[model samples]
Target: MELQNRREFGKKMLGTTLNYFLLESLFTSQAFASSVRPVATHWAKQLTEICNDLKLQKIPPVLWQQQVEKLFNQIELPELLKFIDFETLTRGFDYPDLGVNTRMVKFPKLDGLPEKTVFIRKIFGMKKGRAIIPHGHSNMSSAHLVLKGEFALKHYDKVAEEDKYLLIKPTIEKTAGVGSSSSVSDEKNNIHWFIANTETAFTFDVIMVDLGGKAYDIHNIDIAAGEKAGNGLIRAAKLDVETALKKYGKQHH
Candidate 1:
């Protein structure tokens, strides 16, 4: 009986292990994994210290909607095209019950922008919650737009590295209210990280611009407060506000 129990336990463990490996593989691509090195060196190495002191605040939804709508109206799509580079925007995941999707769009005639690469799409259910992991990117800048719902966004700056990715730092938490958006441009060096802080789920939209190439990269990072409970890869992205403004904000700016 003892021998039989041991065999069954071993079989179950193996099955579980195999299932996990398959799921991870299905979600992550080899190209995306290799892209991490550049993001780590560029954003993590350059801005990790300076941004540590920066804090974040919340923006209300009505104000957010008005601002984005105003910016879109003043900025013509073609004029907006000049600063346009790789665009990746996602919306969804506020309630957990709603489905989500991520899409990539590329433009060639934009001039000075990379060819055959860019991601543009509507996303849903790709983000949620208040607590997120601290992370940085290599060659991307991002703009987050909240089409609907209310949310709190906390910004964090990496202070020190416990080990390659295990970060220790002070955080700046802010709320993006509802219908509002926040953008971070990639400095020649610095990038910022953030998380959602709403009680229930909220819906929002985001646009990510890849400055370097068609590929986007993110490092799986863990933070001090969120680590104890094992919430890994909760918050992350590829780009900063400055880059967002310079490359894509001409219409709004």
Candidate 2:
């Protein structure tokens, strides 16, 4: 009876050990599967289709932005990074004096498309407290994706105009981090400001320029703290580049 009991205990120990190994193997397989990189050509093909649709459909600004956002959502960050030349993109960041810098990813121009088909892709590298000052786009649609670190995004709608001041109502405000994305169009959330909330941050942007017009213009606006309307929209004054930078420049270390 003693021998029989010892054998039963041994069997139980073996069963527990086997179960642990089986579970670990299953988890290892899953981790390896998720780490596999996607086919790079697939993204190129998808981008081509999006650009072609934009040219053919000439969709409304809001709808066009939605389509672009949907397509971008399908791509993973690792897969998208495959197309960018990080060595060139990070060159400026290597030097401290450059401060905040933006570099474009060189992509082959979409062939067999009309001259109006415009594609612009860029990466912005910034230090803490640096900002892309409040600005609005004209005749353009774009998307901003946070690749690393955190950012504060504030968006506003142009509601009323008073001389040089534009009455803008705050629309959306949120904190975004890795894998997060936001979009803009002439009709929705047209004006926005972005500030880095970490020691360093990187953001990628894809822009379709002059979708329905000749040129796309970015107009920067100054916040009017003293001017507020009953409707909740605040007044903003436009500022030149020099003045805007002085007002919104990054904090010094």
Top-lDDT structure, candidate number: 2
**Number of backbone collisions per candidate, in order?**
34, 0
Q: Model 1, 69-158: lDDT tens per residue?
A: 445344333333222221233222233222123334332222233342222333332334422233554444444544434555544443
What do the candidate models score in CA lDDT, each in turn?
0.38, 0.72
- TM of each candidate vs. truth: 0.37, 0.73
After TM-score superposition, what is the CA distance of residue 220 in candidate 1 from its true location, in Å? 2.4
In candidate 2, list every pair of residues with a backbone clash.
none
Superposed on all Cα atoms, the candidates' RMSDs to the truth, in angstroms, are 19.4, 13.8
Q: How much lDDT does candidate 2 score?
A: 0.72
**TM-score of candidate 1 on Cα atoms, chains taken together:** 0.37
Identify the runs in model 2 with alpha carbons over 4 angstroms from their true place.
Answer: 1-41, 55-57, 92-99, 108-117, 161-163, 224-226, 251-253
RMSD of 1: 19.4
lDDT of 2 by residue, 1-253 (tens): 9999999999999999999999998886555434432333445555556766665555676776677677667787776664465555776474222235788776533333233335787888888888787877777778888887898889988775555677788898999888888888778888888888898888888787876645887777887342787687788887776676667656456
- State in Å the error of residue 15, model 1: 55
